[model samples]
Target chain A: MAIFVNADTKVIVQGLTGGQGKYHGLRNQAYGTQVVGGVTPGKGGTDVEGIPVFNSVAEAVAATGATASFIAVPPKAASAAILEAAAAGIGFIVCITEGIPAQDEAKVYNTLVRDYPNTRLLGPNCPGIISPGKCNIGITAGEIAELPSASGPNVGIVSRSGTLTYQALYELKQRGIGVSTCVGIGGDPVPGTNFIDCLKEFQADPETHAIIMIGEIGGSAEEEAAEFIKANVTKPMSAYIAGVTAPEGKKMGHAGAITSGGKGTAQGKMDALRAAGVKVGLNPTEAGDLMAEIVATLK
Target chain B: MDLFEYQGKQYFARYDIPVSPGDVAYTVDEAVAAAEMAGYPVVVKAQVQVGGRGKAGGIKLADNADEVRLHAGNILGMDIKGHLVKRVWVEHASDISKEYYASYSLDRAAKKHLLMLSAEGGVEIETVAVENPDAIVLLHIDPVDGISLDVARDAAVRAKIDAEAVEGVADMLVKLYRCFTEGDCDLAEINPLILRPDGGVHALDAKVSLDNNAGFRHPEWEAFRATEELDEREQLARTHDLQYIGLDGTVGIIANGAGLAMSTLDVVNQVGGTAANFLDIGGGANADMMAAALGVINFDENVKSIFINIFGGITRGEEVAKGIVEAMGRVELRAPIVIRLDGTNAEQGREILANAGIPESKLTSKPTMLEAARAAVALANGN
Candidate 1:
């Protein structure tokens, strides 16, 4: 009962002919994801380890009825790939490519909002989502994420940091706890999906009894998400905001990590989350312990 | 990629936006030459990145070459907010009848291009957003529809811009919008979009921040690379393509992801020690990268010990172990290092480190992030 993905989801690789795309795509297939088809513009006729290949997302959609897309295209072509996936009516698109220009992301985000409301885009720089035994997308190591425990994959995780997401999953696995879904929303100027979006889904999924959210310094996303959780989410939540010890320096960008009036700092986010009745972990290890405490009390 | 005033004016010029004539001067002589070229009553402005230049006395109006030389000499070496000015932008001063504000940026929450226009200018826009919210027109432009002269004029009228200045301001707004979108800028701001005595709209100041990710498309941005201010350790990391941010502490920190590297700093500080730097080796950690990271940290004289915290996700544990072992032999040790390996073949990575025969005084492997942090902190304090 994962929120966005499960055992029955059909997935296609957007840049399957490239080195990283093919490598991780095959690994996802090895993890038992229904990697139905692969898409590469010129060499679509060729197959990669028995997976079907198509030139375009629309072709793959027509050929295999693939509903989801995993995009690993380079930064220059990443926005186009995401737009193409949305245009092809892919319900869920996960972009693992980093370094996408902020303007392109803004355009793509608004396009999805106005033209394609039903389509959901994950990240332009994130480590994708994983539902454990049911499905795995993006780059998270499957072994670190446990299958459904007796409670049925009860803990849900959404993080801005990729490594911290992996760290939290590994920490929870060591405690014999399994995750309902782990989402890496990516820390960027404009993420396709944000902490609030993931929280809404986790709050509704009955299998997800508790949630763990990890954020980093920069952006009002965490603070905004804390506001959303204060009213909407009933499940117990534990959170961590990275960069407490980060050096104070001048910020250049107008968004993401810096705001004029002091909204994106770690202390601001920690204070906001704590005021919302959520336990804020001092470190990644402590973040997992806080979540473990919630899972323990769930029964 | 926040450009200096002169560079920002250059960017505006490319979009056909009206900006003051300006040239950058590295020396007092250059300032005098620029002022002589631009004509009398020029402004000798410091090229430091921080704001409040005028209040800091970094900006001065000079009517002649002698005045230009005096102001340039004072502003060039002056430190404003810890930013030592090394250059000045000497430009012909404009006659302002009124001041207004206009800028283009992302409204992150609304997920749209936020165009902020205000009749109350020559002050911080954030201040206006709070004090007189009605005075500023906050327009959300859909990327598809973009900005046009009519729409800009409509917004100007709503913001209560003076009747005579609306046309000129509207025309400037359309060009500024093009600079933000076509010019690949994260922010393009004209603080005092002045209405001249002649009733012509002119940009008295330009504040532009180009998107770093868009550099691949804009080769012209290479000129700004010379203006990049990096400390010694950061300069070294840039050579190796490693993500490193220098900090003031004793424990040298290295990790695999930006999030983990940052959290590792907090972990170290929580255990009663400060981290010297934040270095993320990313997904592919080979010996060269490990050696390069170690070499860069070794250059920091304040580092008392190093913590190599690798939680292998896409970064294979065995390869990281091998990289660390091999990197140890490459760089001469200035500080002892503690290692914490987890995920994706962590056991093999740890075994490789232990079997490498490095003495406990030099290298020790811990089981978890907490233990590794404690060990590194202890080592840093000479325990």
Candidate 2:
């Protein structure tokens, strides 16, 4: 019912021996992700928190039939790990590392998009994508996710910023508006899937009645997506773009936040989205409330 | 990591791409000797980190040692695109029959390797593409197969180069790919890839950007790293091993989260203010870290106000508050500081800040980020 991940999805943990990978793998296992196995090369044949460790993703895939891979390797080695997972026929590769050199990711993305046309990549610096109520394949908190059986679905959430996703979800939860699937697409200069890409999937999901998209300054991706929304998106959506008054020329936060000399200004994106019939919020606080109001109004 | 022309040319030479004989000089005397070594009619090129040096007269052809001295003297201290010229590249001037352009860089936004080639070079290729879109050949190289010989040939043909010349251009493109990968360059460009009257492709100018992540593998780059000049705040951030990019705003931001910090900027901007810098103290923004963040922001004269937005998770809010309290003891603040504390031990953190009476009028405990941002913006504007 959800896109990209579900209960049948067996997962492999790349860099499972490392602190972050092991910690998250255990937590992910606790959340019922079916963390089938892991890959740590030298630390193979070992088990971290009861999850079997293997030398390579291929071994993990061959033995456990792990469909998805959660990559927690450092920035420099992230792309190589993604290529390894893709080559091994892992269905979804989620990269959690940040500061990946733009060139390296570009090379990795270009190759993956061309060679493994069917395989999907979630992030290089992104929070791993999740299909709530089915499986948690990424770095999103298990406690935050409300299952479909436990809580009825209302909206599909797609956000570039992970923390904002959590905050907005918390707000939605308080209002008793549970998510069908919440995707933290990761806020990197080059994300695996953009707002438009995620929108199509959310729109097609029958459980998802409305959509909420969180964005940041820099890049015309939002503007481009707004154009698509105007033409295609029938579902009502509420949006928030952070960094409204960021210094004119400074890249103060994320790599993608560099204003690109004002090409993708927050205000400019807000205006476009507004024009496209998306309800623009004052901030994250207003985003969920406004979205809930809009959804109710639509009902 | 953007390499100057001289440094880029060195890498081009490694691939056996033809480049005029050249040497880099840090002084006028050294430049004069390099011109002598290159043989006269030499080009005295200003070694700055920007393009358009030719129009700025940062580049000049010198026929003799006297001319080299004149050009190098004028260029050595000249400023080009905010970069002060401390060195000059003296090289043999070329005899150009035609000018073409080529570049390979990561189109990160698109998540692909972008290949741009143009028949019209010697001028800004961007201008050519903007004006005559058809004149420029844009190619997105498949990350897997890479820039194949056939694809390269196709690009060359699209650039309007003759079929015979496509073979050579294709070969050069392959070599350029090697330089891009092997050199760990984010960008490799040959502007004015000249077609000499003798019928050969010669790279008359080189623009390259070495990936900073790969800096560890290339020790030869250590010497070149010395030439870089960063501002005081950036230098401080480098010392702390923090990722900080300075801005020209008044509201200095210190937040536990990157997304929150960015939203803080948005909040500040929405309320009609500007955030001076983007400073993520990471998850470890304790007192010492707080002190470090304060120290870095305080150094910036542009930072008239400060905003601290923290959403404590595994990171304790009380510990963050203690850090800010301690930091206030060490550094005298010239600008107002706003602290929007939330999450675990948030009330306790607020209590600690309140007890210190660290500008109580300036210290408003905001319930939400939006309110805190509005207050900070108002305070920054002296409302």
- Best candidate according to TM-score: 1
lDDT of 1 by residue, B236-302 (tens): 9989978887889999988998788888989999999998988988765666788888899999999
Cα lDDT tens digits, model 1, A156-272, are 999988888899998899898888899998877789999999999999988888899999887678889989999999889999998887655533111254434456778988999
Candidate 2 docking quality: incorrect, acceptable, medium or high:
acceptable
**TM-score for each candidate, following the candidate numbering:** 0.97, 0.88
TM-score of chain B of each: 0.96, 0.87
Query: In terms of lDDT, which candidate is strongest?
Result: 1
lDDT of 2 by residue, A206-234 (tens): 77778898888877788888999999999
Residue lDDT tens for model 2, B1-383: 66778888987888787799889999989998898888889999988877688889899999998888888999999988888898889999888888888899766556677888888888887788779889888888756567888889888998897655677777888889888877778779998888877777788999987766667667888866766567889889878866677877888888865677787777787789988888887643567777788889989987777888886633467888888888778878767777777654677888888898776654567767777788778877888
> What are the per-candidate TM-scores when only chain A is compared?
0.96, 0.96
- CA error at residue B174 for candidate 1, angstroms: 1.1
